[model samples]
Target: MAFDGIVVASLASELKHKLLNGRISKIAQPEADELLLTVKSTECQYRLSISADASLPLVYLTSKNKPSPMTAPNFCMLLRKHISGGRIVDIWQPGLERIIHFTIEHLDELGDLCRKDLIVEIMGKHSNIIFCNDQGKIIDSIKHVSAQMSSVREVLPGREYFIPDTMQKVDPLTVTSEEFAAHLTGKPMPLAKAIYTSFTGISPVTAEEICSLAGMDSSVPAQEYSADILLHLYTQFEIYLSAIKEDTFSPGIYFDGKEPKEFSALPLSHFVNYTRVEYDSVSEVLETYYSTRSLITRIRQKSVDLRHVVQTGLERNRKKYDLQLRQLKDTENREKFKVYGELINTYGYNLEEGAKTLECLNYYTNEMVSIPMDPLKTPQENSQRYFAKYNKQKRTFEALSVLCKETLDEITYLESIQTALDIALTEDDLAEIKEELTNSGYIRRKYTKKKVKIKNKPLHYISSDGYHMYVGKNNLQNEELTFHFAVGNDWWFHAKQAPGSHVIVKTHGDELPDRTFEEAARLAAYYSSMRGSDKVEIDYVEKKQVKKPNGGKPGFVVYYTNYSMVIDSDISNIEELE
Candidate 1:
């Protein structure tokens, strides 16, 4: 998500409207690198949060206030001493850069009026909150970057406050067409990169949006753009920068499936494929995007251990299955041994007591066969030896065939669990998966004998034709959906021959519309392993036709007959129910 200059500009506009002429009533530093200020405006009280965290630099108007430490830090105390009752005169951004300057007027110790600038730079690792004199010379900062840390500029006391790494960018708000053309022709980078690199406050997302608006390919070099294309791109740039200049902004977040993907100050038109969640306030958008994205990332990290276990189990069982298949193939010749024993017993009476070999016609194939015998043994003894060899091979085949089937079944079950983990979204979803693993013997049950009640339920969606579609989130859910929830004549869909969610389309004793069938097939394809494939073959059958073998693994089913279709995995048009 980009918290770029446009967003900062919008935020600056909002602050100027709300905090200008307001008094700084209190200052608190709850975190080592964070500051929470309570501003008292004529209208109401506002809590402004500004963080200079190296990992997450943020500036937002929050309703919640954090508890401060018993002893404030040096920076916090300094801010309190100087700006405790200062009146905010102006709030502004510096030429589309990710920086905000707050000008304050207050009385000094001798009652002399003085002015200071509280500058907050939102650059990633080099972010800092520096208190500067009216001349823009640094007084003190939350973070002081010495000459040893950065050669470009020193941010210590008395040093000049200049934005690093953005000194050369031409402000998009002020660039002329000639200037734009010069910069466009100067860079031999991709269209998107050139736009962002040449202009201040333009992020890669905004650059791509500009390219999309101009109908130019973002990946192609700017040099490859024709003169007319360049003109068109410059027109689109003006359209966007004009909005920022006019103080009109749209704050929103884009979502991929149900997960928050990115947020921006302006509508992200380039993300046509993702769902858009719009907000009236940029602060709200930022807070929601970061918090939701953080939770999704956290859940994925937590599932890594379970994923590793499933992957390792799948690999081991797959290898064992291959070996068992080879062993089963070896036993394919077991029937030949039994046939040889039969021929020997039938023709052995013609052999003399001292004969070393016997030749006879095999009745099974009407072909000649020879059996070698031990000269020291009688014909009856030789026949018994062949019979014993045949019986041993038959026993080996019987044992290995069962073992091979079990290994294959285990492999399939593990794969289904892996797919479930992929679509898992919450802690409860993961809890259900863990429970399934424990039941399937992949995970050992805890000795405490306490179980976490599973609240995770199947995905529910309504088809365009108004039919209900239920998708299993795990193998256990698949079993529950099919055996207990579904009934005869209800349609079931799965990604044919691939691991996927069990999609049951409820018929309710009525014929399902064609649109409903298509929607259910799309759901089946999207939640499966082949989700992003161009085409996924789906098998749809009546729930009654989908039968589970007794004692089979959860979600394991057999369908002797079914209807099939090839469909894409895009389910954006389908409406999902909570």
Candidate 2:
């Protein structure tokens, strides 16, 4: 679910409650698509994370720190100059249009109070972060859009900042009974589609929830409903809207067919009674769902190539093993053929020229060996029998040769895969490793067409300063968290070996004290499959040192000199993420 409007609205609400009247102590763009805002409230300090990546745009309060480029990007410097130490006056969402605007009041260079607007558009494929002056003139944006970049609107400096219009059919929260009745009277659309199309704030999930509350089939034809039924639905929808206004929301799951699949904050019982139902706050629902989904996506994408490489090796080994087994069988057949040939040659002349059978003295075993032949057999027939046995033995030798070569090749392939899996640190690397297994026939492909499960759980650790560190389980996750989730100046750690996950320590820009390093080391050890060894060799390198190898295996990298340590593999001291 690409950071839909509802999630943004929930986040904006949370931010407003926590950050209003708070001063922005620091601002940093640790990554091009991510922002970390340090807000100082009277009760506590808050680290607000905002990301504009289309797949997982989010605004959440976290306690984690991240690593950033040594030299701040021009954009980072610009934000620091303009908005640092600003007081957050308000957090506003534009009627669930996938946009959040932060109104900040700060002292200008002349020491005069000024207000600036920081707008974040959460719409997928069109998401952006723009900084505008009080006059609504965009000073700069995270992404520069010109007439050339977007024919629809130019987002460069000096342009007016305005929300782009999205055509919607109805106001879900304010639609009157008469208006809804008029819209649905002649339309023959599905109930879910009609509601979703009618309202700007209504997602498919919400639409289904409305249908559930009204006791109507979400898939039922809208035109088929009786006027009385329609009136009932409108009344129910009004009640649902009232619930939203009162903030009395519940989380529910949705299903396609029998599988309990998608999750939502609206009750989907009207459409299907999803067996796996859970209730959570609107904020909790967005945070948990998007966080897990983002993590899984990161792991799969980052590990894709590495998994492929490993799986390919595994497959080659399996084939080689099979071929060797076949050759072993053929070799046994050859030995039998050799014995047959020797017996025939020894008993050939002992019998009459046309003899059907003869017994020969076995010189080696001190026993009689019997040779049988065709009745009235000629010299040519006797010669043919000996030659056929000889040929069978020769064919066995050839099979053995091919088998030896294939076996060696397979061994080499298996070894490579093992090595790759050992060095895997990130979810991306794991994804590649898993893919390799699937491709090599080690694991069967999952039949469901939806996204594959990339990482089972995030790699977790406690830093020396008691900060939590998270490592991605696959490539996609690595990209998401490392580049999109982490803040600048936080220590980044990775195993020095091969393709691995990108480990991030959320430091909030404080210098990493020693305990953090040990915690990170433990994480590196546990995440690798070599988790049971007494001492596992780990290479601790800054995330900046880790460079993705070009066209290399997913999560594969080349790092310069890094700190090395041999740490005990026990991870009991580290806390696992829930």
Candidate 3:
């Protein structure tokens, strides 16, 4: 996420090496604020994509091509007229600023050679792609700014194009140690904040990383550290900046589990326990990181409605389950009512007329018991009344016992669906879950002549012992994987008494190794509803021992004999197969 000055410098170096003296073969304005240039060099043909979007400004080399409009925009036409066959002379960054300057040499209308500069400013909402003459006079831009829009500088035709000195931050790439110490120690904020605020184009992420490299807590105040410690910090800062100076860029994306958390042109040693995937080039890093992030964001947006549906279903089922359990608790006194009927029959014959109470010896526990009576009713009638009440209570208990069990089963089924939704990574996964919901009557099924096809497959992984493991992504997949795909000798694993995926390991008739078992158990724990717990209980059994109940819900299975283990949910080391 920190596409700061260092990233810009890396990109500028890449572009200069690849497109230096390269001819601009094609010009495209795919989006209003974006440009895709086809540059032909002696080495290879490249597509350089640039975007000045207010929300997301990006510059990356891509192989993928986007469709341009039928008619080019005015700015596109202008660029095609002036610099269509221009050769890139230089590509550079302006002293650790989030900006890239490209100088192109081309022949004018009368064959006189001319040079123009294309500046891409990545300043968040103020980002712009300004085209200017060699004298720094603006010619045209992808987006124009007037005095009304910004009082600092205007990006219109014939206006001077310059970077605004808004924050007055010093260039970190060339700052001396004495100067660095003097400026950083004077700040009143935390150490990380002071570092970012004192330097140009250094994001808070980078500042924290710098502090981490110095082995200092970034949250401490800047002035609390002594001069010796400050000098050590400066040493670490120089070491970090040396990577950019030597052009030994190590580009990669850091992943927290499956999602990309951040990407950098240099090593981020402070991001402990995160997965760092190294790339050969910064363009590859940017393209991979942004595309993956976009897909994750798109999937989350699409799942909003589906999540609401599942959440609503879970809430309703949970409420019903609680109420049913309470009602079943009330039926616990049904046995006492039956005993009262017997005691009333035994002692009613000796009761005096107009008596309000009868004292008797209960045969059940051989203890003395007193039964209340209706004074106007005969002993026979009193006993009959007690018997009637016992029969009603018995029927109610019988009905509620079955109802409570059904409600509980429903709650468990809905919870499994909820867990499936949590791990849903693709539209097809959500579709399969929706189909399950429709079949289960939670959602109204729409009748059609042709059924929608579900193409989601179980997640596949290979254990360190070379065993193939498959994890279900939804309840239906769980049912398919456990009952149809797995054989008798294969092992099955699941979170103990929790809604989770059914993890099946293909044993090929051999007994699983202990390491493979633990790995499979970890997979079960990681995919379950209790995924983040320090320890999760897992149950494993042979496929033959795991049986689905007749007419049970999908993914519902029972096992009498199984092995249990407690393990953590760290699956970063587990090798996943596509």
lDDT of 3 by residue, 1-578 (tens): 76799999999999999999999999999999999999999999999999999988999999999999999999999999999999999999999999999999999999999999999998888989999999999999999999999999999999988889988899998898889988888988899999999999888988999999899999998689998999999999999988888988989998866888899998888887678999998999999999999988888888787778878877887888788778777768777767877887777777889999889898989999888889999887888887787788778779978887887888788888889987888999889988998888878888999977888899999999999999999999999999999999999999999999999999998888999999999999989998868799999999999999988999999999999999988788899999
Local accuracy of candidate 2 as per-residue lDDT tens digits, 266-362? 4455443234445444445555566555565665566566556656666766776777777666655554445555666666655577677667776
Task: Give the alpha carbon lDDT tens digit for every residue of 1-578 in model 1.
Answer: 66799999999998999999999999999999999999999999999999999999999988987999999999999999999999999999989999999999999999999999999999889888999989889989999889899889898998888777635889899898888978988988888998889999899999999888888899998788778778888999999788888999888888766678788888878787677878888888877887887888898999998998899999999999989888878877777777767777888877888887788998989989787888888777887787787788789889998998899888888888899988998998899999888887888988787855777789999999889999999988999999899999899999998998999998999998888888999999999998867699999999999899998988999989999999988787899898
Better of 1 and 3 by TM-score: 3
Q: What global local distance difference test value does model 3 have?
A: 0.91
- Candidate with the greatest lDDT versus the true structure: 3
Q: State the displacement of the C-alpha of residue 577, model 2, in Å, after optimal TM-score superposition.
A: 13
lDDT of 2: 0.68
Q: Look at candidate 3 and tell me the lDDT of residue 401.
A: 83
The TM-scores, one per candidate, come to 0.85, 0.53, 0.91
